[model samples]
Target: MTTVVGIDPSLTAAGVSTIKHPRIAGNPNKPICATMGRQGSNADTITQTAIRIGDQTRRIWGSLPSSVQLVVIESPGRPNPNAPGRFAERATVYYRIVEQLALRRIPVVTVASKTVKKWATGSGDASKAEMVAAMRELWPAALIRNDNEADALALATMGAMQLGWLEPELPCHISPNVSWPKGVVRV
Candidate 1:
């Protein structure tokens, strides 16, 4: 079975999720979700930030199953003025993840933020609150604690839909309200 992993990269709280579907590969079961980030107020210097990002990336890479065939990550966009160095830090982390996955021969897919938002909430410009609400409504069982998890779920669902692994049970012409089975393993 092939598994798809979706990641929302961040130095503070990077969200990681995995969905396994043998049918997608014409085969059974597969699993995984979690947040990756270093916690420390003393991480002030550039080196410290880099180390933190590396640690987070390593954690995420280590957590992925060997069956992971595809990794979809939220592509980095313009820098956030409230968070200086965020763009560079996230870009480095993203590159590190891609490099590690490349070494393992696992393909990586970078989904645009707008794409995820549109897929999850039917609006490319949906706000964080909208995303959270949409995900909660779609998968009431999962505990979507914050926007990061919601985004991660959206990213995973987008990848699944793109791969034709997650066809919405509901009938729709364009993007439908899709949902995956519950109990996705988390670490």
Candidate 2:
């Protein structure tokens, strides 16, 4: 079984999910084999944020199974001019997490926020509640507690569809523009 991981990286509460599936032309039956996330102390000051990033990065990487085939992470939201500090910290953490995966030679891809929404709810402008509802409607067995988890799960499923690890189960958009890096073997 090939493992696929999905992550919604937030310093406060990152949502992570894993699924193991055979890369064949068929539907995945309740494929949510595992779920885990790293919760860190609040990152307030620059030093605290740096420390949190390091700790969370290591924990996130460790959370993955060794047989992982692909990782799909939800990209950070746009920088809010008012909350510039928070945005910067989040962006930094996001890149550091991605870098850690690259160092380990793992194939990682980041899906845009709207892309995830569109894939899950068939609307780029879908609300967070809408996403949660859609996920509930689609994958009833998944323990999706919040929007973060729902988004991450959607991203993983979309990535699997994109990489040909599973059949497309949703009538939504997986952007044709996503460029998988060199190590990723596209089917």
Candidate 3:
């Protein structure tokens, strides 16, 4: 019963799924247990958000059984060019997660957003609703309230599939390398 936790990190809210890998067929990837963590409003600021996310991560880490083995995090998507300073903030959040997970000595893997989307919906550009619908098909009883949590679960599913805990359920598709249109670094 290896436990793998997938995290969808955000400044205000982070979605976490703790899955107990099962040996069952068809539903081999099902998470025997899961939960989500919400960082309070006061922690929404950039600096505070990083700290809160770290705290939330630590809390989740502490709660896991000794059998737990890996941690998977969805790499924050590249920031919008029109939004100044957003890239830095997003990168900050991502780095914080990686750093914390490393400190815990848990093997961490970062899955790209496009890869996750493609794996879940057959299209990297699929809408949140489309991804949610696909997840429902995979886990009929999964309570997918929002895109954040759904995205987190998708990352978990991908990680589980990669680790061989789950069967190869989705078709194999190669994800194109992420690229920026033009000189858009600080934007």
Per TM-score, the best of the predicted structures is: 2
Candidate 1 local lDDT, 1-187, one digit each (tens): 3778888988788888777764653323333457767664655787777778878888878878887756778888778898757788888888898889878877677777887787777778999999889877766656777888888876776666656766654332145333323322121
- The alpha-carbon lDDT assigned to residue 119 of candidate 2 equals 77
TM-score of 2: 0.83
Q: For residues 1-187, could you state the per-residue lDDT of candidate 2 as single tens digits? A: 3778888887777777776676432353454523344444444676867787777666777778887778888888899987787677678768987887888777898888887887788888999899889877877877888887887788777767776766666557445346666756547
Candidate 2 residue-wise lDDT at 17: 74
lDDT of 2: 0.74
Local accuracy of candidate 3 as per-residue lDDT tens digits, 97-165: 678666767677777777778878888888989877887777766676777667777776666665666
Tell me the lDDT of model 1 at 118: 76
Residue 48 lDDT, candidate 2, scale 0-100: 67
**Candidate 1 runs further than 4 Å off:** 22-32, 39-43, 81-84, 169-187
Q: Tell me the TM-score of model 1.
A: 0.79
* Superior by lDDT: candidate 1 or candidate 2: 2
Q: Which ten residues in a row have the lowest lDDT in candidate 3?
A: 178-187
Query: What's the ranking of the predictions by TM-score, best on top?
Result: 2, 1, 3
Task: Give the TM-score comparing model 3 with the true structure, all chains together.
Answer: 0.72
Tell me each candidate's TM-score. Answer: 0.79, 0.83, 0.72
Model 1: lDDT equals 0.72
